[model samples]
Target chain A: MTYLLLFLAFLRVGFFSFGGGLAALPLIEREIVDTYRWLSKPEFLELLALSQLTPGPIAINAATFTGFKVGGMLGAFVATGAFCLPSVLLTLLVVTFLSRFRENPYVAGFLRGLRPALLALLLRVALSVIQDGIHDWFGLLLSITGGALLFFGKIEEIPLLLLGGILGLLWYGWR
Target chain B: MPERHRHTFLLFLTFLKIGAFTWGGGYAMIPLIRRELVEKQKVLSEDAFLEALSIAQSLPGALAVNTASLVGLMIGGVTLQLAFVLATALPSFFSIVVLAFFFLRFRELPLIQAFFRGALAVVVSVIVLAVWQIGRKAAEDSVDLVLTVVLLGFLLVTGIHPLFVVLLGGGLGLFLRR
Candidate 1:
């Protein structure tokens, strides 16, 4: 029953999410926390963190996590399938038309407008991470330095993630 | 194998590799796809890759998934399209499940807690990086600059539903696109 419900819920997310995973932030939040009542606000934040740290698209990562929490492995598979199935079908149907109208002015305008909002929405998600991830003073410092490295140095991402995990091990393990 | 089977297998392998290895997600896949497919194998022409990327981004799904579908559309047909999309989605699906399994099971363990905490803190920084990169690209002009400020301010202050924000932005964009 919940499997079907999970599928139905993420189906909306799969279709409507524009821009990318971050673009889906508000929608995913509303679906999981506000509408379905599957996860609490705090639980959702943890999911977001996990989504960020894990590989893959952030939306898929979050959906899988939430589904696992709700209904275990089958739930994970169902939620992911439901979430992506619509977009796959929709893409097949629309690619022909989309290519034809790729540069339509209205579409361009629509994308232009969505851009800043997507960035702003990402900012909102970023804040949620700070809220929870900053467990102590050292954690804040680690976040600051990590931000510095990413923005200033432009280090490739895989290493940066590894560094963060290693830093965590050192910071928390010894202390 | 038949020509059709060969194309499908190629699409699957390529998209599977992209999905499994590409980090930073979405836009990050753009360069990798260009390098791996466009430059190396010549599976897709540069123009086709760009066209597909634009179409993918303009549509609703994740860029990586959408791009793979578009690529599949070009290389084979509907059947191969499904194959590509699934291949792209598969890696993330399995990995997160394993991570979630452990995360849920041993969340109470102090050692694991410490590691996740550190990793998550860095994840926060990654979010900020995403914000900067995306914002820098989008907010290229004064109007966009104003839109960024207005939108970011509204999101931070009013806490309006983002659906309304996206809709309002699109509605306003129709007139304001300059």
Candidate 2:
């Protein structure tokens, strides 16, 4: 039953996760955190941090870790397998009839429209994260500094994550 | 060794290297895809690579995984396609399992909690940046801009399922075509 739920939850994540990357985050959060209550919000954020810090795709990392935490090794494999299943099937379908979808305007139009909705979804998720993570003056300051470093200074994300950890240790650990 | 065996072995090794090495995931693997698949292996022509990329982008699921699957299919067949997916995902799978084991174990420590608080703040910043990046591309014109605003508001107000949002976006897009 647990394995089935893991598969179903991640399968939904895989199917609706168009444009990939961070765009898929909102849906993953919905299914895992909201629907199943598998991982709490803070835990989800921590998962996000780990996913960013680690190698490989964020979706795959999320699936593997969530499954492992929720079930076990087999659960991890099952969830990851479920997540990849849609992409395999869909890609095969697309490859087999490559010519038909090559210049399909309907597909293009749908994708174009998808971008805005995806942006909205991402924004909603961001807002919630801000609400959850930024609870005090230091939290606010950290986010601002992190934002500036990421956008203006053009530093990479992994370094920023590390820097944040060290700063947190100093700021919160001591106090 | 037989030619087919050699081809399969090369395919497996190339994808494994890609999955294991690339950091930051998703589109981060594109350069390696170009380097190994196109430049070194000479399996896919530049045009074919781009085609696979576009298709991967269009379809749902992880861009990295989709691209790997397409490339695998192009080179071999369904068997290679499945093999490539496993090869691409295995490294991350094993690493994350190990990491999760540790993370969950030490999650209650105050020091670790402090570290996560800070790290999560950065994670929030990353998501905001993602929103900004996608926003620029998504809101291409007045109609798209309105669609974004309206859909954002709708999501905020109703808290409807994201699947519906995607379907609604695609449907509206078909009719709202300029």
Candidate 3:
């Protein structure tokens, strides 16, 4: 039953989550926190923190962690597989015929329309992450400083991520 | 023996490299993929690269995986599509398995916890920057700005599901954009 629920929950995410991992957050929060009562709001927030820290898609990390928390290793596998299945299948279907219509103007136009929407979705994701993840003044400051450095200074991302992790440990540990 | 077969095999190998090395997923893989395919392979043109980016963003699943599959399919066909998907996903799958095996034992270590904390801070910064970049590119006109503002407002104020917002945005794009 746990495996089934895990699969179904992530299957829904895979099928309907149009804008990738961050875009999947609200739905994930709803299902996990509100509907299933699997995790508390704070717990979900913590999971979000963990997800970001991990080395994978935030959504995937969330699913894995949630699944592990709920039903252990098997749950994690089920959730991850279900989350990915829809895309794997859809890609297969789409790619089968995409070549033929690669040059179609209508296809081009449809895609052209998608770009702005994608951007909008990503921006929404950014704001949502800030709201849920940044809990304190320190967090806000860290986020701003990190964001500014990346945006203006064009600092490479890996080092910034490493620095943020180190700072989190030092600040939180001392406090 | 067909050229298509060779292309598919090549797609598999290339994506395998992407999946193997990419640490953070989705956005992290973007630059690496851009460098490899656009710069080194020269498989996709600039316009196609932008189109792929747009499509990948609008689709479900991991953006890196989705983008890789799209590019592979475009260049090498159905076989390549399967290969790319597998290639992009394999690393995460294996890594998660490894982490799960050890997480219970190590989840409580103070130093490890501290490292994760620091990493989380960096993640926050990375996300903010990504949002800013995407916003700059997406907000082209007054209509685009309005749509973005409205969407952001809805996300913050109302608890409407994101999927609905994305659908609505797509419809708005189709109807409103010239």
Candidate with the greatest TM-score versus the true structure: 2
> How do the residues B23-112 of candidate 2 rate in per-residue lDDT, one tens digit apiece?
776788878988998999798899989988988988889999999999889888898999899988998899899999999999999999
Second chain TM-score per prediction? 0.88, 0.95, 0.72
Instruction: Score each candidate by Cα lDDT.
Output: 0.77, 0.87, 0.69
Residues A1-175 of candidate 1: C-alpha lDDT, one tens digit per residue:
8888899888878776778777777778878887889987756766766665556787878878888889998999888888778667767876755557647888788877777667667677677667867888887888888898888887755577667777888878787
Quote fnat for model 1.
0.61
Off by over 4 Å in 1: A40-49, A173-175, B156-158
TM-score of chain A of each: 0.80, 0.95, 0.74
Give the DockQ (C-alpha) for candidate 1.
0.60
Ranking by TM-score: 2, 1, 3
**CAPRI quality level assigned to candidate 3 from its DockQ score:** acceptable
Candidate 3 ranges beyond 4 A from true positions:
A19-21, A37-58, A98-128, B1-14, B30-58, B71-80, B100-119
Candidate 1 chain B minimal-lDDT segment of 10 residues: B21-30
Assess the local accuracy of residue A133 in candidate 3 as a C-alpha lDDT between 0 and 100: 63
Clash tally, candidates in order: 0, 0, 4
Report the Cα lDDT for residue A92, model 1: 82
Candidate 2, residues A1-175: lDDT per residue as tens digits?
9999999988988999998857678888898899889899988889989998888999999999999999989989999999999999999998887645846788777877787788788888889999998777888898998998899867888999999888888899997
| lDDT agreement of model 1 with the native | 0.77
